[model samples]
Target: MGRKVEEVVEVLVEPIANRNGLELVDIEYSKEGQDWILRVFIDKKEGVSLDDCQSVSRELSDILDKKDPIDKTYLLEVSSPGIDRPLKKDEDFIRFSGRKVDISTYAPINGEKKLNGELLGIDEGNIKLVVDGEELNIPREKVSQARLAVEF
Candidate 1:
């Protein structure tokens, strides 16, 4: 059910994001406590502004109202993915190469399930990372989640 909602919202939101000169990074539909939240993460080269989120929210709100895709009540949230953004697509892996990243695998790789290192990018169905001066090539399918690691 959640996956279906995400798919439906993605189809409805992509055009609006493109028209607004924004990249649709990800869409999430999940229950938090008693409420369902529909989160839309967007990005742009110049970075996303509050106005961008507001505009997308307004337009998307109207579209969702008319389309009425979801059967239950959910709060819609439109915002930037932020510095520690998720790395979802292959393009994201290439685009964020050389950046620090945190990755979790569905199963242990080298006896570790969580890895934090410099992203060496994706190559030939693998996600390459350099951890402690050692390069590790993790099969893309094994990665459960990957995101930029916040550095302070």
Candidate 2:
């Protein structure tokens, strides 16, 4: 049910983002506390603004109200992905190469489930990361989640 809502929202929101010169980063639908929340992550090369979020929320709200896709009431949220934005696509890996990243795998690789390092970008079908003093190559298929990591 959640997955279906996400799919629908993604389809509904992508065009709206594009029309507004925003990149659709991701969409998430999940039960929070006792309510369902639908979050839409948006971005741009110049970064996003409060006005951008407000515009998207207002425009999308009208569309969702008309379409009435979800059976239950859900809160719609639109915002920027921020500095720790998730790396969800091949392009994201390329775009964020050389940045620090945290990667989590569905299964342990090299006896590790999580790795934090400098992203060396994707090669072939694997992701290369410079961890510690060594380089680690993890298959993209093995990655469960990945996001930009702040170095502090």
Candidate 3:
């Protein structure tokens, strides 16, 4: 059910995104507390605009009504991924090259699950980071979740 909904949303959203020159960051359909929420996170090479969200929301709403994919009620939200955007794909690493990031793993990498360093981006299938003068190569598969790190 989850995958089916994601696929439908992906199909419905791509054309709208392409037409508007926006990048579809992710499609999420999940239970939030007691309510089901459908969240679409979008981006652009430069950034996303309010008008961009409006355009996508308007187009997607029409498709959802026509398809009636979900039987139960769900809140639909279309928005930008924001400053701490998720690092979801290898392309994201490439795009965000030289940005600082925070990543955790399923198991420790060099006895650490948490790493905060400059994102040198992906080299082959590994992510390169410099931590305390030591260069570390973490296999992509080991990453649990990663995002842009906030600097103070």
Candidate 4:
């Protein structure tokens, strides 16, 4: 059900983002406590502003109201993917190469499930990383989540 909602929202929102000169980073449909929340994450090369979020939210809200894709009520949220933004698509991996990242695998890789390192980018269906001067090649399918690592 959650996956279906995300798909529907993605379809509905992608065009709006593109029209607004923003990249649709990700769409999340999940239950938090007693409420279901639909989160839309957007980005742009110049970075996203509050105006960008508000405009996208207003447009999406109207469309969702008319489409009525979800059966139950849910809170709609539109925002920027912050400093530690998620790396969702293959393009993201390539684009963020050389940046610090945190990646989690569905199963252990080299006896570790969580890895934090410099992203060397994707190569041959694998995510390459440099950890402690050692390089590791993790199969892309094994990665459960990958996101930029916040460095202070």
Candidate 5:
């Protein structure tokens, strides 16, 4: 049910984002307490602003209201992915190379399941990382999740 809502929202909002010179980073639909929240993450080369979020929210809200995609009432939130934005696509790896990232694999890599380091990008279907001053190659398929890591 939730997945369908996400899919519908994605299909509806992606064109709107592109038309506005924005990238639709992700969509999430979930229930928290008694509320269903639909979150849309957007991005641009120059980053997103409050006005950008409001614009997207307004435009998408109109479309959603017209299409009536979801049967349940949900709160719609549009925002930037922030500094710790997720790295989900191959292009994301290339675009964000040299940034710090947290990666987790389905199974142990070099006896470790989690690694935090600089993103070295993709190489021959492997994710390259520089952890603790040592380079490591992790197969892309082995990665279960990955996101930018804040180093402070």
Candidate 6:
């Protein structure tokens, strides 16, 4: 059910995002208190604004009402992914080159699963990360999840 909801949301939101010049970073439908909460994360080169969120919310809400993909009542939230945006695709790795990132792998590579360092970017066939004075080329297939690490 959850998976279906995600798929449907993507199908519905992609056009809206494209029309508004925003990237649909992620979507979540989860329980909070007694209600199900739906959140859609958006981003752009200049960052998203409250007006963007409100516009998306209004338009998407109307579509959701008409389509009724989700039968249950839920509160909808449309917002930005913020500074710690997820690195979901290979393109993200290329786009965030030279940025600091934290990544986890499906299994240990060189005896570790978690790696935090500067991302040099995606090369022809690998993800290059500089860790501990050494650069490790982690193949994209091995990465489980990655996100920009907020450096304080």
Clashes of each: 0, 0, 0, 0, 0, 0
Overall lDDT per candidate, in order of appearance = 0.97, 0.93, 0.90, 0.96, 0.93, 0.91
Cα-based lDDT at residue 79, candidate 4: 95
Could you tell me the lDDT of residue 140 within candidate 4? Answer: 95
Error of 5 at 23 (Å): 1.2
Candidate 6, 1-152: lDDT as tens digits? 77779889989998999999999998889888998989999999998999999999999999999999998999999999989899887788889999999999998978999999999998876889999879999988999889999999
Q: State the lDDT of candidate 4 residue by residue for 44-141, as single tens digits.
A: 99999999999999999999999999999899999999999999898999999999999999999989999999999998889999988999999999
Worst 10 residues of 4 by lDDT: 123-132
lDDT of 3 by residue, 5-37 (tens): 988899889888989899898888998899999
Candidate 1 Cα errors over 4 Å, as ranges: none
* lDDT score of residue 145 within candidate 2: 95
Candidate 4 residues lying further than 4 Å off, grouped into runs, are: none
Pairs in clash, predicted candidate 6? none
**Residue 56, model 2: Cα distance from true site in angstroms:** 1.0
- In the order shown, the candidates' Cα RMSDs to the true structure are 0.8, 1.1, 1.5, 0.8, 1.5, 1.7
Query: Which 10 consecutive residues of model 3 have the lowest summed lDDT?
Result: 1-10
Error of 2 at 121 (Å): 1.1
Worst 10 residues of 5 by lDDT: 82-91
| lDDT of each residue in 1-152, candidate 2, tens digit only | 98899899889889989999999999999999999999999999999999999999999999999999999988998999988999998899999999999999999987899999999899898998998979998999999999999767
- Shift in Å, residue 119, candidate 5: 0.8
List the candidates' TM-scores in order.
0.97, 0.95, 0.91, 0.97, 0.91, 0.90
lDDT of 5 by residue, 18-107 (tens): 989999988989999999999999999998999999999999999999999899998999999988898878899999999999999999
Q: How many backbone clashes does candidate 2 have?
A: 0
Cα miss at 2, model 5 (Å)?
A: 2.5
